[model samples]
Target: MTTAATDLRADAEATLQRLAGSGAQLREDQWRAVEALVAHGRRALVVQRTGWGKSAVYFVATALLRARGKGPTVIVSPLLALMRNQIEAAERAGIRAVTVNSANTDDWQAVYGEVRAGEVDVLLVSPERLNNPEFRDQVLPELSRTAGLLVVDEAHCISDWGHDFRPDYRRLRTLISELPEGVPVLATTATANDRVTTDVADQLGVSGQGDGALVVRGELDRESLHLNVLSLARGADRFAWLAQHLDELPGSGIVYTLTVSAADELAAFLRERGHAVTAYTGKTDPADRERAEDDLLANRVKALVATSALGMGFDKPDLGFVVHLGAPQSPVAYYQQIGRAGRGVERAEVLLLPGPEDKDIWAYFASLAFPGEPQVRVALSVLGDAGRPLSTAALEPRVELSRGRLEMMLKVLDTDGAVKRVKGGWEATGEPWEYDGKRYLGLAKARRAEQQAMLDYITTDGCRMEFLRRQLDDPGAAPCGRCDNCTGKHYDPSVGEDVRVQAQEVLDRPGVPLAPRKQWPSGMDALEVPLKGKIKPEEAAEEGRAIGRLTDVGWGPRLRPLMRSDDLAPDAIVDAAVEVLKGWGWTERPTGIVWLPSRTRPALVESFAQRIAAIGRLPLLGALADDAPPRYSDPEDDSEPEPPNSAQRLAEVYGRLSVPVDLDPSSGPVLLVDDVSDSGWTLTVAAMLLRRAGAPAVLPLTVATTN
Candidate 1:
């Protein structure tokens, strides 16, 4: 070998020792990737399994490149947990790494100073940072010019074809274009099918030229992962099994849920059953999330019941197991999450406790994908006519989309150069953008196919590991001797009857407190709404109750079907509603009950109100009359209208709800009933009318709440 080649090998060996241990060495493929980046200065994409030491390649390369007086490496990471792990791992290799993310806003200036002084060897940034106005305008250009290496972690997100396509990661194309020639770029992910791989490689290529990335892909299989799927009839049954068998799992690990509500609910149930577990979700406070992660890492907690917020980048080498309470929408996403387990252990158990409601959850998330052409046109028209950048909040009322969906659309549009996000918000760029109907339809088809594949995964009597590897198009797809189907089922499928009864009791216990809206949304008058500021205490409804949240695993399945059905609520729901009223602990019993006008399910709402009044022995006051025309005038508009914010909703309902003209003014207090409470504005306005019509107080009750 040449002297330089021999020296490079020796240096790489020393760095590997520092990264892994004294006896650690890079495998042939890993060395090839490191050499491609450090010696050949070629862009590379590494599609390896979770525990294959993808981080080591970049860290070692960073060390070698920095030694040659090249600028510091910048890693665009997807999650804070991953960033934390990478920073620590980099430190162990004698590399100084600093992170700038939303959590460490106060430290950004200091981190920038360190980066400028050449005191930092590596800098980790969240992908969202790439679009920040200040960072993009001021810092990004310099980083693009000076960065010795650019690493995109969780790189599959860069491709729209990937299961977790993040629009912010698409901004990397602009950054990549700005980079000087010969600067090595590395994109690494554990999950990417052949299509996603090709798409990502094309995106990583220089200006759509010939293949620019040196692809290093290995078999996407974890030998330590013992995969299994347990089909349960109901969500409660799944919880029962978890309660029965949680302790028998290998070690401390994660219990994944498809929704934030499920994570919190499952964690609460497990804790009630005497398990040492904590809930981790998107709503978890950053500090608390850090503590929870630490606790799990230190084996202080038995498991962290979490949503996908805890997925992607969390690294725990010896994590003992991973359990899913519900199936994720796509097998690719499922593979990414389960990959978290069995990373550093001989055999980490991975189980999927699939529920009947899994498909419903999947469908709900799928509905949030890119908007239709009509919706996109509406957004652009609103922005273009305004002539000023409008924040998402301001734009929400004018557009017929939810705030989350609206923002996501805006980000995608911004990446496509149709809209530009500025200091205030987003403005139209006047660029004529064509709606890619074919591409979107293809994506929708792909998603459905993925959902079906997950269903097949549940029922397939074939090797579970082989099924997942095949989903990723892994060339080495074969039956692993470890999965449940390959070997006999290692986990008990049945829960004790006593445990099932307890789980049913916990889930069936209903009544979620409905907090009253305290303040109105800002800028109501500009929309020609006659409301502003905090809601008057006398006009507001008292804290209320709903039978359950539509997202709750317990009542969700039961209540959701009622949403579209014209049939009266079943006997069980009526009994639950009565239970809610009995346990309400009100200071004064309501003298009368009134119902809100329901445009969609009038029959269901009226029946529920009559039943409640008859059972409670309260005076049955008539339903509140809607004096105004239907909320939307266009009869042909089949699209579901986005409910206006608090102020707009209040304005629309202000003069519309009329109390019974013959009702006695001395009716003490009244119970206001609605089929569902979605912005809580309908109940709010109705309560204000009741209070003004001489009731001393108004108490709102609904069968379900849309949170």
Candidate 2:
């Protein structure tokens, strides 16, 4: 197979020019991404957020590569719906696309053959399809001869921390590696944090610059959406609120429910109210599911009542709203579901219903997530006594449950803090027990806290967005200023009389009431550092320390660093000192750090400062009233952010990348950084370009840069 760069790629360039002349205006990033692909001969990670026209990153690159006479790109997606979605989009763009899924056996073979023979430019298949040993061994090897790329979409699935965790995704690393070295790998996902990015690079075996290659993200916020949170007293009240708003909310929308019964009943209720309603659930057949999806997309139905499973790959730009009938199990799930609306830059609403039932449901789910102490203890004992990996089947007789139930319990335990799942079997994490007298007390305590958080969300009048942001471990978020409590007349209390004010006044007095607040740092140990501490204002003032401890640990750092040599007020001194500590890696910026003796990483200094800054904005509520339903002076802004260096860009770039470069060419078509290369355009492009151009040697390096 000839590489695009080696062949001088006139055909590809001609095809690209033709497409451009035919009305395809490539954006700068897209152009740069594609150029990097052809020039470097290696994969690149492209992480553009939604509405960044990420598809063009792949569509144009694939078209350009194929136009240049390179082999077709084989995209391994996770969902069949995603395959169909992309294929249809490609067809609309005048690009030929097909899929190899379970539904089409003979055609799948034919397509596989065509791809191997260099007859096709793009083929999409679900990741599960590649799990077939026969396809991986037989068909993939044949296709390998023609040169192809492996594109893993929704790359976050590879990380266990992702909300949508899939065990099958773990095998993606092996599958990509099986491709010849020259074939670049691209992995993309909408949401990826630092940990997720690291995991993705590790799984793909990306090395050096290529391993670190990823596009920073864009904001995921849609200002057109009028976000709202309606805290109802009961499930019935939630239904009533939905009914009240149903007439006002126009355009097609989705109503996501927590249960199959809820979806069905909601659909029925809406139908009774004289609206065309479609219901979708896991039980729906493929035909029905597809029809329901099409109906929702086509605006044939006024509303579709379904579960979170319904919206993964469905792109309905005009969806005016997304209603969560019940609180989601986690903030991640909530955000993704609500993100479905306002895709078209139009005003939309995300109505969250957190009724009493939701609290019960959340509590039940938390309990399920954290098994009983006896169960955890039993599982641990079994694992400890075995001293060997025991399969669920083997452990069932001793555990007193069906193998399936025991396995699920074990998974929950894994999800919770109780155990770890391994290829061999489950094992105790060996974390210390929580309570000395009781064996399962720790597990119980964790479950109770989780449940309590759920209850807090349902009952608290505080800012919902703030709670969510805190849960996601991101505190830079300000009040959304648009949620129910944030905008309500009830929130208009005098700044001095706000919850924080009252709490601060009470805390200002020294007494037993302040003692528990002193332990706030220890009680909220997971959120240590940048909370509160025990240092006195006078001492802090004299020492030029920016932080004064409220509790032994939880006080926000005083803003001493803001002080100038000529003017050093106590607050200014504290803020200024905070900056110094942050610079010295003793505090986290955007928040402050507590003087905890353990787990103090230097990188978290700035984060600690930032955390300190966060709480200062809160009206000082007394320690006892701190946990109560504190009234918000204003809602904190915690809307969806621009994809902050997400994974989507990287995956898309990798998909279309065929170039690999080394030594950071001072002058060249582009610099391509790939994790590794055994065969495709990356190495081919570099070698051919250097030889043809008569330039210096090209160096290909991986973090563990492959030769």
Candidate 3:
């Protein structure tokens, strides 16, 4: 055993050295952690939040293990997207790695052949694939015969406690049982608490005896991060706050909302305010997700407003902030979601806007934890068995509860420090007990205490990290010192603070417009849309008439008109106030959709019109591919037959519609004449054609993407 372990250690080291040479810069602490894994003859469990380079730990470990003559290293991941990404990354690094996913059959066969022949170094497989019988029967037997290392990425999912729990993940332990006895196992995750740590070790059957399993915890501190949380009341005010900030902190950022509809609406709202935006949700097509991600990375989008589904393995280093439109269930989820920002060594911002609805959503989730104590006790007893820990596959059918209920039970147990999560199983932290012989009542009391702890954190008034620690019973632990509450600051929420302040100073009055700055000769215009008053128009009219009869006070043109309009709705009256602007060249498409073509400043009109047109044209062009021809003659007009695809559509549209003279290659920058970008085919193809036609550059402008 000693000799074999030493050999594995040596092999893993060489791989790390090679990786370091290949452009991954590991800090002293990070490199030390990798070396510790090899030197101790132990499997490493690296838990670091997003953007901390979690992938590097496994990549280096797998490389080192294989270089030491390990037959093949199998990586089990949750998503096929993640698997594909790793495969492509390895190939780009000149490492021969292949993956078996839902996409290919021939590729699977080739990988199986390579494993059987002991010719492959890294084999990336999804957890779902491991359950397939054909691959198990035809290929796994060969893997058992050779020296192999099993790497579970996103290992936290093995715990019911994690935000993302897949039923297929539980079966991973059973599949790993097929590996040679004493074969090493390594698991990696972004967010895992202490309970999650122990669960991973037990699941892999490498426990207290130290069958070479070690924990490596990365530092969670991100000094460049600036966190801000707003306790909000009104929807319009919330949007108003967002608009004010985007201008100051301009660049790539993600605005995370609770639902797809919210993401779409928020994206639209931001785009209308002149920000280039994109919206994403789980319902978005995978290909479209890839395109949106690419556009974001290329700086084609200034912002992306999305739901939680957009996260995991998506990296863009220069993100300016990660704004939370709604509160998440737990700090773990919040941390993972917001860790996407400030990754490029710049000070990044985090804005959390919480509303009353968040409280209800959290309460609903907490309500599912009933009988939490007994459920945790059951989970503990199951893990404490001397036999191999039950994998996700084995536990699901045997639990006799819905998968969601089981997951909730697991999370409660894990959060309460009653159970620890292993790579493929869990570890019991001893069964739940009462303070005295009254076991049932004691358990009930304990469970309530735990529930209260969770609730207290949610509604806390003090330091956020302090509350988190108190819930964990680790109150002495120093504050995270990174959260909004810990920072002791608040961004000005007033939408017109600067203008109002300037006006106040200039006019020596509270309500007045300030004079313009030296460069901006036009005064700053920021209007506050008022809320409807409680009094009805009829009541107001009666009050007005009484006052007039007594004091002989007559109303003027503007003031008297309001007294006579008893039938008008408050919203209708406000709408009428803006009618003159609309008739004088302003445009109103629908409620919440308005633009000013005339009477509006020239620069603003030109910018907004271009953005609107650009967005409208995207649907027509998105049908084309990268290699498709630039232009095709219209066959309907006795010209060459029109190209049948996206490329052809672009040519036809450009041929027939008005091409902005500014976008003509012979002219200046390719003009972007639209506000939203749903499918980028039109703009992308047009830009490509212009480049092919010798244009120096094409500027594609859009208010937002369907994202």
Candidate 4:
């Protein structure tokens, strides 16, 4: 080899050793990726399996390019956990890396200063940061003009066809168009299928151009993983199985759940059974999440019960196992999650405990996709008429979408050029946009197909590894001798009856407190609703109790079906409601009970209230009389009214219920009963009317809450 080429090889080896260990060496394809970027300054896409050392390729390239007097490398990462892990890995190679994300706002100024001063070797940023007002307008332009190398980690998100598409990742196209010529760019992901790979490559300017990106794809196989699937009939059975078999797993690992409520519930149950585990979800506090990650990495805990928030870029090399409590909707997502295990250790167990409710969860998430033309037009019209930028919080009261769905829709609009996110919030751009109904319908169909594929995967009798490889369209798909199906079933499918009984007890336990909404939604006055500011103390309902949340993994299955059907109140639910009442420590005993009028499921609410009244021996007051017409529209109607904010909801229900005009004030507090509490506005307004009728107070009691 030439002197310079030989020297580059030696440097790459030394860097890999620093990153991994003394004996670490790059595979042939990894070296080829590094050479393409550092020597030829060409864009490259590396599609390999997890644990293939994608980060090492970028870190090594960054060092080589910086040594050649190039400017700092900029990486657009997707998650904070990934960024933290990358920064530490970079430091191990003697490369300085800093991150700018929501978790570390105070450090942005200093990080930017370091970048501008040419003292930083690598700068890591979240995809969302690319659209920040100050960062986009001021810092991004300079970074684009001067970056030595650009890296898009978890790059599958750039394509809508990918399993985990993010609109923020789509914003990278703008940044890509601005980069100067001759700057090497690299995109890497382990989860993309053939379609996603091609889409991402074209977006990286790798197709229909001179010297398209060199695509480096290797065999997508992990010899260390022993895959298996166990079908459990119910959620409680899965919990019981985990409690029984978790200790038998090899070492510290992660337990994946499809929903946040499931993660919290499973973690609590595991802890009660004397296991050291913590819940990690989007709802977890930032500091607490970091601590949990650290604990798992250090082997201080048996496992982290987590949702998809723990999916990408978490670096625990020797993690012993990965257990899925429920199946993800797509095989691509499932493969990515299971990839977390057996990265460093051999024979790490990977199991899927499939449940019947998996498809329902998948459908619920699919409903939050990009809004249709009608909804988009409504949002743009609201912004155009306002003639001012509206923050998401302010826009929420004016729109019908939930806060999460609304933010997602706005981001998609912002990317499509129909709206511009400004300093304050968002403004209409007046740009014509077309809602691709065909494309959306196709995407919906694709999602259903994927769900079915996941189901097919569960029932497949062939090699599990080969099944996943074929789903990714990996050309190297072949049977692996490691899977449970390829061999025989290696995992036990049975749990003891005692464990099942214990799990049932935990799931049946009731009482989730319902916190009252204290402050009102913003800008309600413009909507012709008079309510604003903090709720009056006397008008507010006291903190109340519900049998459970509708989303709780324990009670959700039971409560959700009840909400949809007009079935009679289940005896178990009635008993649970009594237990809640017995345990509820009210300062004053309720002298009477009042039932909230239900437009739907009146029988269920009345039956439940009667059961409580008979058990507590309180006088059963008559149901509240509805004087006004039905304020809420039928949920099954396509033209149903948008969900109203607190003010609008209160306005609709105000003066609708009539308490007895001459009800005795000598009666103590009254218990207001409802089938469900969504916004808590009905209870708030109902409490105000009861208090005005001279009752001392009103305490809300419900079968389920939607929060």
Off by over 4 Å in 2: 1-32, 46-48, 143-147, 206-212, 359-707
Query: For model 4, how big is the CA root-mean-square deviation?
Result: 2.2
True-vs-predicted CA distance for residue 159, candidate 1, Å: 2.1
Shift of residue 89 alpha carbon in model 1, Å: 0.9
Over 251-348, each residue of candidate 4 has an lDDT whose tens digit, in order, gives 99999998887898899999999999999999999899999999999999999999999989998989999999989999999999999999988779
Write one digit per residue (lDDT tens) for candidate 2, span 401-452.
3343476566545434456655555667766544222523643564455456
Candidate 4 global lDDT: 0.87
Colliding residue pairs in candidate 4: none
lDDT of 2 at 501: 38
The residue-by-residue lDDT of candidate 3 on 588-624, one tens digit each, is 1211111212111234324344333343342121111
Candidate 1 lDDT over 1-707, as tens digits, reads: 78998899889999989989999998988899889898988889999998899999999999999999999999999999999999999988999999999999999989988998999999999989999998999889989989999999999998877988899998998999999989999999999999998888878762224545578999987899999888888877999999999999988999999888888889999999999999999999999999999999999999999999998889998899999998998889999999999888899999998888888778777777888898899999999999899988778767666677888899999999999989999999999999998999999999999999999999999999999999999999999989989998667678999888989998999898889988776666656767777888988889999999888889899988888666786789899999999899999999888888877778888999999999999888889988986554211112654434444455567656777787653568888888888778788888877878887989999999877
**What is model 2's C-alpha RMSD?**
27.2
All-Cα superposition RMSD per candidate? 2.4, 27.2, 21.4, 2.2
RMSD of 1: 2.4
In terms of lDDT, the poorest run of 10 residues in model 2 is 511-520
Model 4 worst lDDT run, 10 consecutive residues: 633-642
